[model samples]
Target: MEALFERVFVETTVDTDQDGQYDLIAVYIKRPKLDEKVPAVFVANPYMLHCNEDWYDLYDVNTNIQAYPSQNIQREDVTFYQKDPVVCPKKEAEQIVENSPYPEPDPSAYECISDLYGHLLERGYAGVFSGGLGTRGSDGLTMTGSEEEIFAFKSVIDWLNGRARAFRDKTRTVQVLASWCTGSVAMSARSYLGTMCIGVATTGVEGLKTILPEAGISNWYEYYRHNGLTLPAMDWQGDDLDILAKYCFSRALDPNDFASIKPLFEKNQKTLQEGEDRQSGNYNRFWDERNYLQHADRIQASVFVLQGLNDWNVKPDQGIRLYEKLQELGKDRMMLLHQGQHIYTYHLEDSPTLGLIDRWLDYYLKGIDTGIQNESKIYIENNLDQKLWMQEEVWPPKSYKSYRVQGNGNQMIVDDLSQTIYDRKQKNTKAWLDELVLTQNAHSLSFDLETMKEDTRFAGRAKVSFRARIQQPTAILSAMLVEKGKQVRLTPNLDGDENHSFVFKMEEKPSDYFVITRGWMNAQNRLNNYSKEAIDPDTWYTYSFDFVSNDYTIPKGHTLSLILYGMDVDQTQLPFVVTEIEVDTASIVCDCPIE
Candidate 1:
């Protein structure tokens, strides 16, 4: 065992000035007898090992180390002691009495337990612990100040410096990897340590309720309750930051305490809420600004984020915002948005998701250079077609072309073969136009496209433009894509009011050659925003609706189709409209070009 054990000794140093110190160190220690050619791997949890019990158990069994029971034991071989059986050095023990600034049974007492555990585990190539504040009290509004919190956070820098020492002693290299959770303490620790931190966060909402049987309040709602009110079923609730502010206000036991924290909390909550409202109906507000992306510009370590677009607890855009901010910061980072809800991405399949996490660790902690550095990828689960689309680039690729709807008197064609309009009174025209306004039931108008000569692979934005006059003052136009011949509805099944034009944006997937872009205009506001272009009498003001891009393969000899309606069959409420629908060919453009 002695021969197999690496001759590495770990020590720690502190740099109080914030200057980069003990930098450019390897992440792991290697035995002299082992091959020097392989790179070392480093892993850490700033909190106690119990916080990550599964990982702790795995590492203990793999390394053949004796697992510590929940209770502590006094053993010289065990460098650290657990909180259940407190241990203190003789000299520092006296300092607790002479110089202690905290009240009796100090909130920081847990630090001693954390230190003892860390000291024992310091023998390993890596360390792990929790760094964030723990929620206490029945309402889950109060935070506990434990010794473990301080040790978990402070020990991150300590461990990094120790790993550097271990590398120097072994004549090798070392890396520092940290993981944590929660918003306040985790972020606070990250700001102080200036090291790479990885962890999952919850906005206090349960995303599992989306697919699971159990239903609970969303994090936003919890936050709202903490703010002394419940969310109104219908109303534009400002922004993400505003919601968070409301929560903070509710949670403040003493409104004057930590007064500085309120403004930032409010601002972040509103910003996150607004962005989320634009993309999804889920009440979970997860914004990168207050969590991961706050210090993104200064982070030197590679960041990897995994999130779910369909997660009802955390807004998917939080991951996107981080990815965008990382790109802007010119940092080495990667983000993966899967077709899953919260916590589902951790499961393994024939094609495993955990395998991806392994690879990410291999590249970052082991410095293996797996060629994933400085790249971004998005995996969109097409709810419309039930397929996945993987794109490598920034958000909303600029290459997407915006196709316009053009056609008058019914038979619509997109390609440049020929322009022909069909009138009920005319001959030689293929199809006739029928204008039906939706008054009571949702009205639908379908158009068949001309046959295609070859397979067309479209990649980009798709939009619908039409002239609409509502019988009532206000109306909503709901659009959807369907199969040309089969007339299949290609929209995802969702729960909510369909009359809202913004609700249409939540459809993560739409069929190829089919799109639904909705418009809500009151009859009093019939005048279109036609300042840039002239409106032809033949065509009423053309209103454009944007849809999520569809990377669809239209088979040869098949036609493209579009459906316009006032309401979805599944929706409770209905839209009112008077429609003269026309479909036309429109150019599609991407949001950004891929390099």
Candidate 2:
């Protein structure tokens, strides 16, 4: 096993930093030594290779929203992001000898979960790991979701298939061939690594068979922004594409590599920052290039989507959009929406939705008839019962029905819009919900929904529409649908478990409610999230959007309610601006899928 392990650099076709040559991708090969060729499982990730010394640092969130634009945004601002890459400087690239310019790759980027990859290798296949272009040992700049970045990942598979070149060392003297493997490849991982799988699969690159994207991102725009509002992932305030790119610009770790590309890297940062559109938070060519769903027609590979329904980091919508697209295309695909947070579900118990991923890969990568393809298209974990897994032939289930409520009386959120935002810095969700249900507050609007007579299932997204106008030119609009009674819920097991799985726990004294799902948007982005036209003060703007997809059963006798609030403590950004919202209580419309 030791003798078969080797590190190599696969040459890519682009020079993201344009330092006079095509970029190189750093890869580590682990294939079986058997005479019979096997398939390969490739992981093209930025996190596992050379990485930034530190994680993403927050940007200044104290600033106010961008002033409403008086006119349509400049065309140059949109088209510039789509400019073609510069012509390769190196018609015939110069050879970079081992350790000549960049240092060796540090394998400590990921926790090296021997349990997962080790098992795959034992199944008589090769496993390849790569920190895509612009990581520590690789050339180019780290621009997430760029065409160059996607092609660089595809380049590794090209190497495995003998269509691209890879050198055993920087000398470019001895070549490392994937002679022990078949051309078929599958990419399987969680988070950004999984997202790369979607990006590469969209290219429809030959020899790439399938992908298992667990908690992967399909649209980079949605990841960083919500309805024209800068909403960074997790609790990372003020984070955007540039900050994320800077975080993965791992090449800076090597002194020699850093010095050679310092100017280029700095320029890359400036370009990224400018294009990210942090101020307007509107979608542009920058976001469009990163949206893999738009190119779904090019995907030839089978896809198996796995996402944590409770995951906010990558969000369920990331997997939902791509999987639905594949379903619409009549492509071979499957989806496993689990109750866990942002995590891999292979180790989670198999009512066998995820465990079948092994079989799915075998069918695609090794031409095995696993019969997994004959199974249902969707497998969703029951949020009410973590151990129970359910399957459905179609989304929303056949029995799905809509439950809705309209605003009864107008209510106002008391945050002062005339002044800079300071009141919403640390809004508490639970406390806010408590006020809405137990002690009605002036800062939010709550509508009591029909109570469920029997245990009722809700699967799929919930849409909220309402007519509202604020005292200011712009405001943040947020909504939530909740179960007004306590229920044991699934929570992530963060106690250092090997699986990083989930556990169902009931609060000693169950809380007042559980927010089924929620959504937010910059109210000014009414026509679409990509548009940011100024809203006339006191003019009614209709806001409508779907909350994150969810699957749960509201207990019998438990009432449900639709809560409209000024801020979402978890997802939205801080300035609880907007002095008051003149809401048409009767204008609130909810399309809730109940089964």
Candidate 3:
């Protein structure tokens, strides 16, 4: 493809540091060289164009290279390194250039999205790729999913629609306008970028025709902690926001910009610390802002939500819950659930995801009669091994049966009897990250299902209600649905000593055990997920919590097990309390589609 439009750094309308002056955002634009306006597609994310590992290695480090040079001018004649005299002093930018979290990106570098945008330009669509606030060349301190972060996204679309202002240079001398945009836009991205799409879409921003958020989070609370239980600790303890800021926030910068950005860093850090109460994992207004689901009714754009059913990182619930909200609002939406883990469908061989996006964009942005609206609302890969994909008009397929299983000592039975004991002192098994405890623990209880006489799939969250008594005042519990059975295992069968990317051999063998789904809760927060209440020691209370949603099949003869245990390690350092659980086995039933 040929260079069609010059890449320009467009400053957005967000003063992230509350510095009165607006923060600068970098945008690389490409489009057909025509007088007619075109619809635009861009992936809004904090990871700048050149941050991808592949792109970093593909391009040379040229701090002075411009992303898009004038059509008539040679690229070698222009210097890309333009400093902001007001916000980005030369001394600060030089220091940041020397020592930043991420090496400053060479403006000329191209990555996957850049290539994708090139294709978009060829299709007569404009493509604009912008780095998130606080990223390289973009102004402001990064706050992963904060309101300011989301507002930055809205500002981009506003710019396209002529409602927002954007500057072309550091001094705001050259005003770069989105004159080539038709005021119709679509946002597409995976993971965090996708998250930005959701955040912006909820605002019902004008000119945003559609959004495709793959594995994007709808609730920040759900993203980090489940219900009341925080994820296990590795080195850090307390809120997940701390961990997110530690990893995703952009601290890397140009030395010329560092002096202005340093104070912003300290301010953002202080805000994060004060905003998210690390002492308690409960929800607050801070989390409420991040919870896009609450504002789902405000969404005006069509949505194509996709997520891996088995994805635990962002969790399937993130996208699934949003999909459900969109449905309730009678919004134009479609959902695709596949049998992968936090992956993009385009990465899969011969996937139709791109085609779907094209059709969706066409229908919304171009008003083309693509008939995407008539298509099935939901598509799921029913079985991974068989590669069985199924479509339905709605999620939680209506044909599924609900079977109530009661819990007996070491056995899951059809009988319903109330009250089972969960004596925490019974076992001292420690919890690990995302892994089920295969071995029996005194602090845990496990009930097993009989070998399946027929192939059965649990396609949704299993409702678990039980009465429990705690020896102490507080306790955190992890419940997991596990499958234990022999299955054909595939291992790489290699020839010679070389491991080729596309040329891999496989050997099949028998293996046992796979963790299907898991859920967590704090004992005191049994009634409200966001609030904690004191529990009297030895007083029996009926606690109800749902297991994480799943779509997994237990082949005939395989046994399914429900294991409950206390998580010793936690992000919030709450004192460990012993818990005893009693349950009516009949109250525990898996509600899902079988076929």
Please name the candidate that would achieve the greatest lDDT relative to the true structure: 2
- Rank order (by lDDT, best first): 2, 3, 1
lDDT of 1 by residue, 277-334 (tens): 3222212222211233444454444555555444333434434555566678776555
RMSD of each: 19.9, 3.6, 12.9
Candidate 3, residue 594: lDDT: 55
Angstrom error of the Cα, residue 177, model 1: value is 17
By how many angstroms RMSD does model 3 differ from the true structure? Answer: 12.9
Query: Model 3 compared with the native: what TM-score?
Result: 0.79
lDDT of 2 by residue, 1-595 (tens): 4215667888787878676666788787766667678899888878765456475677776555665764466545554243565565333334433221223244465433234676787777777888876787788888888888998999898988988777765555556666666899999788888889999998899999998888889999889988888887765667788877887887878889889888988888887887788888888878888988988999999999988877878988899888888988889899888877876666564447546877898889988899988988898888667777898877667354454555566667764422322244453445545665555666677888778899888887888888887887777788888888765545654334535453434355556677788888887787777767787765777889888888778889888788887655556665634457778777778888785
lDDT of 3: 0.63
**Number of the predicted model whose TM-score against the real structure is largest:** 2
Enumerate clash totals for all models, in the order shown: 53, 3, 22
Q: Considering TM-score, which of the candidate structures 1 and 2 is the better prediction for this target?
A: 2
- Consecutive 10-residue window with the lowest summed lDDT within model 1: 207-216
Computed on alpha carbons, the lDDT of every model, listed in order, comes to: 0.30, 0.75, 0.63
- Return whichever of 2 and 3 wins on TM-score: 2
**Alpha carbon lDDT at 19, candidate 3:** 65
Which residues of candidate 1, in runs, are more than 4 Å off? 1-134, 137-330, 335-343, 348-352, 365-368, 374-398, 409-478, 482-545, 549-560, 564-595
